[model samples]
Target: MATLDESERYRILSDERRRLVLEILAERTTGIGLDDLAQAVTTRQTTGTDVGPGTVDRVRIALHHKHLPMLDESGVLSYESEVRQVEQPRVASERHA
Candidate 1:
């Protein structure tokens, strides 16, 4: 596992989207499909607003190309790009515990 200093941890959690991703992952025991995760995030982001498919698509793309990979690299979560799955690592889970 990669060790994250305080600054690195703060940097990773600084983004609202990344924080949301971790929150969603915390509720699940298994990996989530990228599409499902993206939808969930979009729903949360635009709770009372009417979000279109395009908005969801944008969030999906961001997660796939940016957020997921960053979190994966930081050892905060396990993101399988090819399979498009996201799950919190045991270390991350334990931190929540």
Candidate 2:
């Protein structure tokens, strides 16, 4: 796997959704459910907008199709596709510590 430098980490973290995901992951000791993560993202994203099940669904889709994979590939998080669990990588957790 390729190493992510500071700039790349910043780029990956630039998206609000991705940043939220990382923040949520960082707070949890165990893997978080994807649905719970999506809800948390939706809660933050819907502050001044029309929020609905559709909004949650859209976030879920984006997380599954785009964000999660990118995070997994970047060594930021370990995404268990079958179980839909998101966990922080040891290196990432160490950095946070």
Candidate 3:
């Protein structure tokens, strides 16, 4: 279960879109990337909103400029983890003087 603080961090997202995205991610083991996630939200005709349209652009802009950096900074999700294809650089145990 997500803590209130964890959930609250996403208040930047409107409730409707956040719920929509969570629904999609809930159905999948691997998470969707931002572009695909936007398409999923917007294009789902069953939903009452046009989440498939500007939401994608908004999500991309937010992730590129805001949300992702904040999430990364908060240690919620690592930027390196999102880049699955790239081998994450190992942190050095010590720095030389």
Candidate 4:
């Protein structure tokens, strides 16, 4: 596995959705959910071109297969569940259910 540094981080941050991911993560002190991450990226105004909120296929699947694992592997983020995301909010919901 490759080690991550500021340069790699910046490289990852350059992509639109990936940049959004970094922005969202930077906004929070703790980790956010995978779905929340996708939602945060895609959600937009009524008239705007929403790139995601799209087939739900790209964001959801890419998030699971690529983004999440990349973040975790790069030591940028951490979580338990891959299928549903394991943020504090989701964990609470899981507990209450």
- For residue 20, what is the lDDT in candidate 3? 59
Candidate closest to the true structure, highest lDDT:
1
What lDDT, from 0 to 1, does candidate 1 have?
0.92
How should the candidates be ordered by lDDT, best one leading?
1, 2, 4, 3
lDDT (Cα atoms) of all candidates against the true structure: 0.92, 0.86, 0.49, 0.60
Per-residue C-alpha lDDT of model 2 across residues 9-88, encoded as one tens digit per residue: 88898999999898888788988888988988898877888778888999998999899999998888889888898887
Backbone clashes in model 1, listed as residue pairs: none
Error of 2 at 37 (Å): 0.7
Give a tens-digit lDDT track for model 4, residues 16-54: 766666667667877666677767766522227545446
How good is model 1 by TM-score? 0.88
Instruction: Give the per-residue lDDT digits (tens) of candidate 3, residues 1-97.
Output: 2234745666624456545554665576665566666566566634685454566676556544554454445433334335521111223442232
Best by TM-score: 1
Residue pairs clashing in model 3 are: 42-51, 42-52
Model 4 — TM-score against the truth? 0.60
- Model 4: how far residue 53 lies from native, Å: 5.0
Taking all chains together, the TM-score of candidate 2 against the true structure is 0.82
Report residue 93 deviation for candidate 4 (angstroms). Answer: 28
Model 1 residue 13 CA deviation in Å? 1.0
Query: Taking the tens digit of each residue's C-alpha lDDT, what string does model 1 give over 11-82?
Result: 988998999999999899898999999999999989999999999999999999999999998888889999
What TM-score, computed on C-alpha atoms, does each candidate reach? Answer: 0.88, 0.82, 0.45, 0.60
